[model samples]
Target: MLDLRDVTLVGESIGGVLALTVASALPDRVKAVVASNPYDYDRRYADGVRRGNVFANIAIGSYAIPIFGAINAALENRLFLGWVLRGGFYDKRNLPRDLLAEFDRVGRRRGFRYVERKTFAGWRSWNKARALYKNVKAPVTFVYGDHDWSKPA
Candidate 1:
């Protein structure tokens, strides 16, 4: 376990939602939050992808399926991952090769794919986590890239 105290939490994408959730739960320990491209605004999992690409929206929906989802996850190679991730950046150059490599490495881990599939399958529950945002007493700074899937509203 980590011995955390008076901390500032920073996260991107779904991780941003996680940071806010934790800060709300441990209000005294968390001092501030930096959330970039948080997934909170989307009412449905597919809605987030719809803002970016139609094909990606369909693919994201398919991730909730059992057998087909496993097949899709298994078929995700570095090129495919790069293609999907590059869309999130306003300037593709911002996504360095090393960062993409690191993401690829992490995605290939044993249970990582399973976790991603499960997360997509239970996206409604995760989306509901936005309700916890009001409970977060810590000051939050939201960051958004020009081409981020989440719109600044």
Candidate 2:
């Protein structure tokens, strides 16, 4: 905790939920938290954020980009790792190459099995967090898109 910085825990989408866990874990250290398109996963599952190029990298990209690292944790399988530009972001030539490079980096690591285990592990578990949210004592900021659930807070 010595390295704990008094910075805003800005969690975008599910990251928001994770940030909540961190803040709640170290309530005294966390100054505050910002959640965007975040979900109360302890009570509900928020695995429905499939927009932007992010989803393509996490969901469809695996199987579509077979060689890419896509982990279906539940099934313990990896696929092509296809990427989809969400919410009209799919226009060609405009997609950023840096994003692709990031995916490639993530893909090269797992090769499939590794990704699957980690992905599904998160889905099937993460319960201690449930109790944490119910009793969160820190100040929180929540923001969500009217049409989308993954907006930045």
Candidate 3:
């Protein structure tokens, strides 16, 4: 087992969920946690955002399958990457082109797509982390962007 005493965890997006999970599980060891845009699926539904559902699960799950995931691999190229990032940010025009190019390059590497799909599957498992997040005794802070796509209505 790894010793995690006095650790401060920092994460953004889905990573925020991971930081919270770690902090919750090792409350005595974790010193603090900082998260930005933590993905909370249940909260999204409760707030009537209406994105995640059984069908969405099935669709996201399909991406983890080799054959089905090929489609995602193709679609994740540069053209769509900018569009996706633009939708995530509050200001689309201000998005950095170099960042998008880097993301496109990293995303094209083999197995990145598969791993991404698996990460999406993990998002569906947020309820498990959420349970831990609720029980966390460690100090934690969460930050949110003004136009986060996951914002509840």
Q: Under the 3 Å rule for N, CA and C atoms, how many clashes does model 3 have?
A: 0
How well is each residue in 1-153 modelled by candidate 3, as lDDT tens digits? 787589999998678888999888778888989988777665422221124344343444456567766685566567755655565456668779898899889988888876775566554577667777876778888887776756764
> What total of clashing residue pairs does each candidate reach?
0, 13, 0
- lDDT, candidate 1, 10-79, per-residue tens: 9987789899999989999999999887777667654665455555666666776779978888788788
Candidate 2 lDDT, 1-153, residue by residue in tens: 358767578887457778888887777777888877564442222234333456543553343333443334223212323344333243456546677666556655534455443443464345455567755567888886565533342
Query: What residue pairs are clashing in model 1?
Result: none
lDDT for 26 in candidate 1 is 96
Q: Whose lDDT is higher: candidate 1's or candidate 2's?
A: 1
Give model 1's clash tally: 0
For every model shown, what is its TM-score relative to the native structure?
Answer: 0.83, 0.55, 0.78
lDDT of 3: 0.68
Please report how far candidate 3 places residue 6 from its true position, in Å.
Answer: 0.9
Q: In model 1, which runs have C-alpha deviations exceeding 4 angstroms? A: 1-3
Best by lDDT: 1
